[model samples]
Target: MYFVYDIGGTFIKFALMENNGNIKMKDKFPTTAKSAEELVAQMVEKFLPYKKAVKGIAVSCPGVVDSEKGVIYQGGSLLFMHEKNLAEMLARECHVPVVLQNDAKSAALAELWLGVAKDVHSATILTLGSGVGGGIIMDGKLQSGYHLMAGEVSYMESDFDTEKLRGEFFGRTGSAVELIKRIATKKNLTDKKDGEQVFALIAHGDEEANAIFNDYIYGLAVQILNIQYLIDPEIIAIGGGISAQPIVVERLNEAVAQIKAANPFHAAKPNIVTCRFQNDANLYGALYNFFIQFADEVI
Candidate 1:
């Protein structure tokens, strides 16, 4: 058995997997702790019982990570700046081999291995939720550019207005979460638990909700166009909590159609599909990475 972990800013998801990619057990908990050491300690305490059965571990995290070095360069939203040798720490504590990857890259691997990108040689995955996260797969392999941050699509600028709105209209980081928060605040809507609620209101014909949704979709479409021009992937997969809403997908498609109509290109437009593995793609992809890295020892 091997262990897979998907560490996000708000939560950490874990799964124990067999050699054949079946999950034996899975669990999740809050990721916010005082420090990385505390978080690792907590994980060790929870996973110690199954240590003997596990062969290795794979981790997917949100940040600028040095995958080759097994150190986190920067924790974007997690606020973990100090260099932490994740693989070494885990290997010493659990006595097993460990592999690490960026969360977006892991999710793309999941899609390529078992989800929407299974048959495609090149693809891009966009996880649209708290933030717009992305991963690029080229020639059937994950692409981590010069510094292992190639598929970071959120930082791509659309227009001057977007740059201005990022902080004033959105928030400090100008993230998807900030955009949603701004929409909810402007609409005077309370109890906004997730992105789905915002979409639900839009579906109910809320004018302010509609306007916010339109702008969000337009910004996303601009990014998609940029990605399409850059990699020209065979397909683009959409993941994350917001992608669960059918209306969002419909609106996104509409925006894409508008773009295609505006600028006719010789290459066919790539098929945009929803991710098959929803929220668990990262965890499963982490397991896939572990298997790929330590296949010989696993069996």
Candidate 2:
């Protein structure tokens, strides 16, 4: 068995996986604020019970991670810094090998190994939540650029305004709790409780909901178009909470069709689909990373 941890801003999800890629047990905890050393100490305390059963550990983190060196250059939405060597700290505490990967890259690895991108040689996966995230795979390998920040599509310039698109959006909606605030504020409608409530309003055919959905789809389509022009992968998988909404997918497709019609490119458009693994993709990917790194000794 192997232990996997998917670390995020709000929560840290942990799981134990069998040799056959099945989760045996899983749990989650709120991610409290702490220094690098303190955080590692907390993780070691939480992971002690599973140490004897598992051979090694694999972690998926949201930031610029150096997979090979086990260093995190940045901890987006988390309380970490550039100099922290998370994997190294974990390895020291547990006396086992520790592997680390970007959360989006881990999700892509999961899809490539067992989910939608299983048969594809190249693909891109995008996660849209509080902010957009992405991963790129080429020739059956994850592509981390020179700085280990290749598939970080969120920071990509969507407008010539010099400010990042995500920064602008995130400024309005502080957390996932506030996504509806931006939607309601922009459309001059009363703020809903959450994203699901916004969807409910859309279901009722509210004009404000419709307009918000349309604008969201257009923004997403613009990013998709940028990705299309850059890597032009064989497939593009969209994941995150929004992916569960079929209306969002339909509107995104419509916008894509419009863009394709305007462009005269003879190249084949990338196949866009929803992620099959949903919220568990990162955890599964962490397990996959553990298996790949410790395959010989794991069994």
lDDT of each: 0.77, 0.77
Model 2: ten consecutive residues of lowest lDDT: 168-177
> How well does candidate 2 score on lDDT at residue 190?
58
Model 2 TM-score? 0.88
Per-prediction TM-score, please? 0.89, 0.88
lDDT of 1: 0.77
Q: Over 4 Å off in model 1, which ranges?
A: 161-176, 263-268, 297-299
- Candidate 2 clash pair list: none
Among all windows of 10 consecutive residues in model 1, the one with the lowest summed lDDT is: 166-175
Candidate 1 versus the native: TM-score? 0.89
